[model samples]
Target: MSQDLQYWKQLKEKNDASAIKYFYDQYIKLLYKYGYHFCQDATLVEDCVQDLFLRLWEKRSSLGDTDNVKLYLMVSLKRSIYEKLKKNSKTTVTEEVPEDTFDVTFTMEEQIISSETDQITKDKLLECLETLSGRQKEVIYLRFYNGFTPEEVSEIMQISNQSVRNVQASALKKMRNNMDDPLLILVVGKLIESFFHEI
Candidate 1:
């Protein structure tokens, strides 16, 4: 097994602070940023992230082992956020349209060093992203930006594999229609470049 898997094994077996801390150091920012995409509140996202880790540690003895820590944590954190939002009536925007959860915006750090072409590309990218439905944007971010598999994306989004495929197809189709460059070459390539750097 890999080092991460080893650590996860230790965590599941030991249920210790150090083991939890290791995961916290690695995943807190990712969970926070991801939760922020849905909630648009930094403090709330932070709380949800902290709570997710706390809950993980508290239930470590009961939790199953996992090789895919990122996908697991993303799935858990998303579920935790929705549960919290539902409990707090003020946080729940609507019961009927809970899947309309994304409001992702590019961060300053995510911005490319400015130039005429870069700015134009950024504008085009943001415009195309805006045209995507909230659920579609979430799927794109989870798939291309975070590098999750289609099955993992379905798990995180609580949708079927077929639904995941359909969503990806539709999102890429929209991007291809709006974009000057090929969807994967320009879109996923640029996202991959900046995404892994920060995460």
Candidate 2:
């Protein structure tokens, strides 16, 4: 197993505090960012993230081992937020909860040095992203931003693998149509350059 995978094993087998801290340090920002995508309310996301780690720690002994710790955490956090929202809201049925909850906003970093042309390109990228549907955006974020496979994304979003591919294809096509240079979409995610070519 990789060293990264060992941390999870350590936590599960030994109840190691360092392993917990390692996971916290590695994933807190990502978890918070991902949590916010589901619920715009920062406090609820923050609380859910905190409670997630607490629950993980408390239940470490019974926790199963996994090669994909990040995915495990993401799945756990998603369910935690859903349960919390279900409890807080009057909507008793799962189907009654709004499906249009995924939201993503892309912005250029202030410190990145860029030319006038670069700025315009980034502006157009943001506009293109805004035009995508929520499911499309979520698929793009998972596939490109987080570098998850379509199979993994299906697990995360609770959709079929074919649905993941279809959503991503539609999203990429929309972005390609709106973009002046398709390569410029790399600003959004690490896998964009390669995935752009694949589609």
lDDT, candidate 1, equals 0.73
User: 61-132, model 2: which lDDT tens digit per residue?
Assistant: 999878788888998999889888888898766544565688988654442223444666667767888999
**TM-score quality measure for candidate 1:** 0.77
Residue-wise lDDT of candidate 1 within 101-158, one digit each (tens)? 7867643233332344465566676677788988888876776567777788889898
TM-score of 2: 0.83
TM-score of every model versus the real structure = 0.77, 0.83
The lDDT for every candidate, in the order shown, is 0.73, 0.79
Best by TM-score: 2
| Candidate 1: clashing pairs of residues | none
